[model samples]
Target chain A: MPQISQLPEFYVSQIFWMLVFFGLTFLVVGRGMVPRVLSTIADRTTRIAEDLAAAEHARTAAEAEAEAWAETEAAQRARAHDLIASAKHTAALATQANLATATARIDAQVSAAQARITAARDASLGEIEWVAADVAQDIAQRVAGLTISADDARAAVKGAFTHG
Target chain B: MHQFQIEKLFGADWAIAGHSIAFTNSALWMALSTLLLIVFVAGGLQRQVVPGRWQMAVEGFTGFIDGMLAANIGPNGKKYVPYIFSLFMFILFANFIGLVPLGLIGLHPFTFTSHFSATGVLSVMTFLIVLIVGFAKHKLHFFSLFVPHGTPALMVVPIFFIELISFLMRPFSLGLRLFVAMMAGHVLLEVLSSFVISGGNAGPLLFAVAGLPSFVLMVGICALEILVSGIQAYVFVLLTCVYLNDAENLH
Candidate 1:
């Protein structure tokens, strides 16, 4: 049709304009506009990455602080446990010392009571021996109508008492 | 048929350095498309940390191209983004603008892509770039592109000739695909619209009966054309990328 037949006449002009317009579009869009769009995308990605990194850093710091506090608490608890154990040990030692002193005092009181009892028995025995000797001498003089010596009666009484 | 007519808007039959430089409807639309693209892209150059809607749209388009280049051409293809982006934006805008029925307002909406001359130039430019890049990267080895690595020596001559012809046809095929598709779609729309108008002139009753079906079919075709427009643009750029890859990698 005319589009095919008039190619020689129109082709040059079409190509000419095509070059002009196409070249302008290429320069303005490719060189001017595209880079801006690309940069905007790059900026957004960078900001997101930065925010994530900051959050991770904050989390790490918080974890470290918690760990440190836990360590301190553990150390203090161990110290308190040591103090309690030492107090218990000292109380036991003091109770043992007090018990030994009380037992020694009770033993002394018992020995003193036994000594007094022995003294009272010895005095009664002496009195009984003297009475017996007198009685024996009198009986001999009355019944037998003989003069018996006092020393002899006493010896005989003493021997009888010893044998009984 | 009248939609495809090229009329001079300004500048009397002019030429510069023995070259005709008349400003025609085709040139005006091309300029308009370029202007709109500039405004669209430049308007969103806010560099906001969180992009607004306009910025998001612009960035989305850029990312689409970036991903395409990365997938097809690898990292080295990034440098050619400007050229490829320009082609995509120009063709896309030209296609969409052509769909507007400015004739309802007594204004001509000339689609540059419907013209073979325009698409031919574009395809040739792309092919030239491929050649330049191929030679620059591979030097004398670029000629080895026609030679299959594991072919019988006896069949090499015939295969080489076929490969050479295929290689030479790249530009014609690329250009013709876009031009023919665009021209055919617009011509169909023009014909269907004229039919509706002529049917109405017959009588109101006949218009209602005949025009309705034509109108519905035109609407369907319009939707198809829109799809084709987008696909053609994508195909053009995708083929460019593939050619570039071949140039760079020699495959």
Candidate 2:
């Protein structure tokens, strides 16, 4: 085969071209092209890494903001509970004050009614005593036909009423 | 048969001192391959943050070679990425370019790797680099690479000679393997296609019977050649890395 033969005529040109082409390929690809490709790759990687870091930072900030919001919400909730408790305490105190005033007014009305009832009972008893005395005086004069003093009748009636 | 014939393109028989120089089809194909690589590299120069498919493919190839270098030669192998990657792309493109059927246009389909001159240059370059690196790094101790780690005094001389021969044979083996594999595949395809053509001339019925199987086999071989093209390129690079490792670590 022609390939097996080292025919210097064919080999010389082949070698010459091989060196020129291969050397050019090496110089162009190894020196010029490869670095460009590598840099592009490196650039892309760096950009990705930067984007990821930025995303991570944004996520951390968002998490911090969320935590702050939660803390504020908790504080507001506690304040609301405190306000409700204070309002409830004031309402209970006001209800107790109103009840005490109503109770005092009712007790005063009950005491006045009791005083009026006692005054009426004493007045009725005095009237009853006078009537009894008069009757007794008249009856005594008629039955015995004796002249008795008005003062004596009165005194006897009084003593009888007192004993009854 | 006609594909292997070298034709001078335009250069005259110029000789300097004792050397002859002429531009040929082999040079044209090599130049074309280099141009393809240049265009390939140039196309990816834009460096998008979000790369398109072509850019991704280029980067993927680079990463593949990077991974190979790292695996075979360790972290220090990163420095040789350019040389190794260049070798890989050149061989890969040469093999693939060879498969293009340009014979219809009466142009030779140049299978550059099939030529020993091309593969020999590549292999010799690699071997030289390995030698230079070994000697530069290890100096005289580089010779000790031929001596086995555990060997009797009597066995040392013979083993050393064997190792030396094997080491010297690296370039020839590397070059021949690629050349043979590529040449064999192409030759088979050529022969089979010729059979189909001649079978058709004999008789339509014979053509149908013989040409059909030949066509089928041709397609199968074509696929195998494609696979072999990639495998041979990978093997060439892999062996270079192994040689580099041997040089670097003296193992």
TM-score of chain A of each: 0.54, 0.70
Query: How many residue-pair clashes does candidate 1 contain?
Result: 0
- At residue A24, what lDDT does model 1 achieve? 82
Task: Please identify model 1 stretches exceeding 4 Å from their true place.
Answer: A50-164, B204-209
Candidate 1 lDDT, tens digit per residue, B1-251?
77787777776478766768688899999999999999988877888887899988888877788789999989998888778888887898899898887878998898889998889888999999999999999998987888878879998888889888899999999999999999999999878888899888999887888887889999999999999988999999999999999898887
Residue B116, candidate 2: alpha-carbon lDDT: 90
Residue pairs clashing, model 2: none
User: What is the lDDT for B217 in model 1?
Assistant: 91
RMSD of each: 6.2, 3.5
Model 1 Cα lDDT, one tens digit per residue, A70-103: 9999999999999999999999999999988888
After the best TM-score superposition of candidate 1, give how far the Cα of residue B24 lies from its true spot, in angstroms: 0.5
Model 2 residue A89 CA deviation (Å) reads: 3.2
